[model samples]
Target: MTSVRQGGTGPRLIVHLPCAWDTSATYGPGDTVFGLREGEKCILEVAGVNNGRVFIDDVEVSQGEHGRYEWTAAFFAGRVQIVVTSSDASEAEYFASVGPSSEKVADEQFNAMVGEIQKFRASLLLGSSSAALAFDDSPGRNKLDSLVGLARLRLYAPGFLREVWEICRAPHRSLLQAERRVSLARVKRLHPLALREPLIAAAVAGQTSESPSLELLHVATSTAVQTFDTPSNRALKALVTRLAAQVSTLLDTVVQGGLGGELQEEESRRPRREHFLRHLLKETKVLLTREPFCSVSRLETSAASLTQISAQPAYSRAYRHGTRALLRGVEGARTLDHLHVSPTWGVYETWCFVHILSKLAERLDHFGWKAIRHGVVSAAESYELELSSGIRIEAHFQANFTAGAPPAKRVGWSLSRFRIPDIVIVVQSAARLDFLVLDAKYRSKRDNVLEAMESAHIYHDSLRVRQQKPNFSVLLLPAEADVPHLDADSFLFEHEVGTISQFSPGEPGVERCVDLIADWAMRDAP
Candidate 1:
């Protein structure tokens, strides 16, 4: 749907996308074709030049005659760029905005996925016992790795800023006792200790026997005044200041992480991300200049102040939630620092792992289960959720399982060279250890689903745990519509291998999958 016209004598590039609808016109640095569903084939035809090469997402594509390049890629969501370069170095760029086929609102779905990831990262920060939970050790290190954390900040920062601004506009004030010198006639409540000196001076001046002159009797009086220098206000200011500093740090990180270099020319031609970060920074700066935040002294954030804010009916929601989210955002930025600009499939895969773990935790709670160790699993770069009910769920994200790998790294022996699954769940109980291999495929197409199921088959047949095969090897797809009923019945449920369609955060389908897995784990519980 996107049409590009070269300004001068250069190779003309036209991209034909398989979009379900045309909602808007072309905009931004590159021409964008909207409503392009995920897993659809797109064609790029370049004319008026020979020996020209086409690149989709910076990878050169094999082209046929007439410079026609067809791309039938995997489950790719978000903006994808197509660059066509001629032998003379003339280049034309076009972008394709791909969305989920199941959901109409692509941004909402993507934001929801990011929110889930943030929640997961937050849980790790609180539940992790190992030192490997450090930010530098995060998986998927890339220059744009901070984008995910930034996206989370962008999603919640506006509301947080608004709340802080509102609080500053009418900040909490309390009556504070103060001492000031006042004339005898004006002093309503004079302090006895402070009046002694004035009385002694009056006696020395021969005024003690008679009514002391109002002008001569200057005594200190204790009075109360309503001021904004309360503990809650100071805490509010501290949190806002911390928020501003963190946001500024994030902006600097983005700029230093090559936002305007290769990302500018290749991946992100539009300055939307940079612009968003700057806008957030501006908002935080403006909020800091408001009433209480400007005048109130900084107070170290403590549990008592936070609890006070939460206990107050007026400031509870805004201050309490704002402070918690600010802290969580900081932790998320650190923990998920390396997860920026991850592929859509990677995002979905991580979401599945977190979503399943959360649901399993809830399920285990019914059986009086408590978390014993929740954090990174040593140097393997995996997350582990261990419960007191003799159940430990360790998630291996894109881990290599080869014969030569260490025991901690290898889930089970694979007959092949190396089997790297998207997510591998190892449920260790008192009686037995069960392995559940889940392959997250963002693609919903029938062919892509069948191809993705091959991984489930491979894990089921090849992976051996103590000479026993895996109990369950499932393919986690995006939505229910992605899998056909016939295929689900004939190929998935009939065998030990299954398909958990609609396996996304906050989706109802997730409960069924969680129950299935939790039941399997609880069966081996002693």
Candidate 2:
């Protein structure tokens, strides 16, 4: 309790104000008050004020152990008044303001930051919960800039809730370990934004990391909650949910100026703001880099920002639209050379785009003719089908040989597998040939049918399952090769991959490859 003496000779007035959420009750480890999901998001505001000039006054409060919110002002005189209210009206107020004169109040500067934080928080609840959604009205990079502002000021706010700053960061190994010995609920009280920052930053520091930090906010009638679930060996789950219930219009009026913009945004790019970013960077920030299955990829990067817009719906729709648009635009690229390539890069936009496409094909609940299985497809074939259109079959496949050390081990698997012939094509019903296995060779010349047949026979007889041998085994080669067919139909001169001698072994000609596979499918059935 912080109170200022209405009448007194004390150098400082002792004014005791109430902490937020006094009635709704403080949070417990399992309490559902915050409703925070593992990946759920909401922009948050955890603001504090010090009017009493209380440097020694350690105002301590918390939602759990070690997660304490403590901030000290200039110094606690014999008396003072200090208070912390949310940007919203009437949720939960955390405060104790002390001052020599009861008239002394919260600084308008502080109030303005709270106001901006509130506006952003309010906006999160408006549309939907998914941040990656690409809606027309979705909040963009601007939300990150605004969130940065709150991140900056909140770090130094006069209450003793300082570790909220660190906890918000990626989390220091030593400090967190030390915190466990303290108590519980001491950690959840800090703003989720404050807690989320460091985690996002680590991704930026990694060998490869760069992405936008988006806001995910959920709003309810009296309160809106932003939360994350942390796994613990001893604890079932740790859910950190921050709520703002006891907000006043007057206070919201005070702290609304702290929200911000993106690194390159017109406002954020200004030279004057360089110091602000520098300060944020210097403050030991961290942000959550891992955002799988969620949008608003709030990963930390080279820059620090405080923007907040609940753009879940906006981002998703935008990404879907944008990718589809990008794909439609790809027809101009006639060859593989046109695809962007950078050396040593572990990931790329192309990869992300392809993955997202798979996500789309899956999500719309639409299954195409692809449901029909075709003969085996090569690795290149699988890659092509996903990217290319028109003539196609199914079983998007890949052919790969696991390598081994010694030469003995090397020729090992490759020879045995290759023994059966690389492919089998089918057209079905028309041919009663039973089954046809097509062996593709780089050699422009034909193989010695008797010798090759003997090797293949050995491989076939080894098949664990016994019934009947393949009705026909094919050997496709260049038109210039010698012909030897144990069974007259067993061997044929067919141009597919390339001339036998000069053929590039791995590159399967797309059309030729498909025809060969379809041939096998038709033959193998009977």
The model with the greatest TM-score is 1
Q: Write the per-residue lDDT of candidate 1 for residues 1-526, one digit (tens) a residue.
A: 4544434455565556555324223232356555566657766666666677876654567877665678764444655666667788766656666665554225577668766666555332221100012232333323333443454464457777777777766788778899887776775554557536957456546766786566766776678988777777777777667767767777776666543224433234234446657888898788777777676766656776777687776567666445444433333345432212344665677777766666776777743333333322221246666677756776566655665333653336666666777766677766677777777777666777877778888988877655557777888777665556623535555688868777765566687778777777777666
lDDT of 2 by residue, 63-142 (tens): 22322233322211111112232334222222222211111112342223223322322222111011111112222332
Error of 1 at 266 (Å): 11
The alpha-carbon lDDT assigned to residue 40 of candidate 2 equals 21
* Residue 508 local lDDT, model 1: 64
Candidate 1's C-alpha runs over 4 A off are 1-34, 37-75, 80-96, 102-107, 118-340, 366-381, 404-411, 481-494
At residue 68, what lDDT does model 2 achieve?
Answer: 27
Summed over model 2, clashes come to 143
TM per prediction:
0.47, 0.21
Best by lDDT: 1
- The global Cα lDDT (0 to 1) of model 1 is 0.60
Candidate 1 least-lDDT 10 residues: 125-134
